[model samples]
Target: MNKKYHDVFSRLDQKDKDLLREYSVKNTTGVIFDMLKIFEEHQEFKFIYEEDGKQVNLVEISEMLKAEPLSEYGWIARFSKHVKDHEII
Candidate 1:
């Protein structure tokens, strides 16, 4: 937490702080699954990709699940995404 944003966080009322704390702990995990479900319905996955030596982010690509069950397929993904800024954390 930076000193610049300390006032912003400190100004929150107890109710607001409680709500934010609850959401941060409870809803964080669901966010990923919700996004995945939405993308499954849309038949696409948005990810970063490299092109011409530059990383193009939020690139939408179509995907299909492999025929085999995940257990049989060993839950393999063709590629994984890494957030450059969040790598250390």
Candidate 2:
């Protein structure tokens, strides 16, 4: 898993793109690079979106983020999203 901006952009789905659009975020390499830089410089910097009543972080970690169904003790319990949106947690 490469950390290059292109690699991240490649993995972005329509939902991800829409999230970025809602924030007026540009997909340009330079912008993404700067955003990553900001994240690296600030420990508290986070770009978050609420989906399924759960927070999805786009900056802190990638592999651990997902858009899953909300539950009292699902992935949200670990602050991570999952791909299954229909299973009972």
Candidate 3:
């Protein structure tokens, strides 16, 4: 695991961590990166799974990623839909 991402990596549940580790071992590129792109674009942590059969929302994931050093930057921006140019507030 990369030291830079240790905080976010630690925030994940063991199951999620294990899965990420497995992906790291099995893939050199593409799959995991694509998955990250999809996750960030979608902005959801529980996007890949359900808890007690309930769907997870962006707010929860945002809170989780908020403390990560790089999460508050561009990496998360890609997940958000910019409507500021269209919506009049």
Error of 2 at 60 (Å): 2.8
Q: Tens digits of per-residue lDDT for model 1 on 58-79? A: 3243343222112223222223
Clash list (residue pairs), candidate 3: none
Candidate 2 overall Cα lDDT vs. reference?
0.53
Per-residue lDDT for 1-89 in model 3, tens only? 58879878778987887677657634633454555556565644444446899776543566433223223364434555545442211
TM-scores for all candidates: the values are 0.31, 0.32, 0.28
Per-candidate count of clashing residue pairs (backbone under 3 Å): 0, 0, 0
Work out how many backbone clashes candidate 3 has: 0
Candidate 2's TM-score reads: 0.32
As a whole number from 0 to 100, the lDDT of residue 70 in candidate 2 is 26
TM-score quality measure for candidate 1: 0.31
What lDDT would each prediction earn against the true structure?
Answer: 0.49, 0.53, 0.52
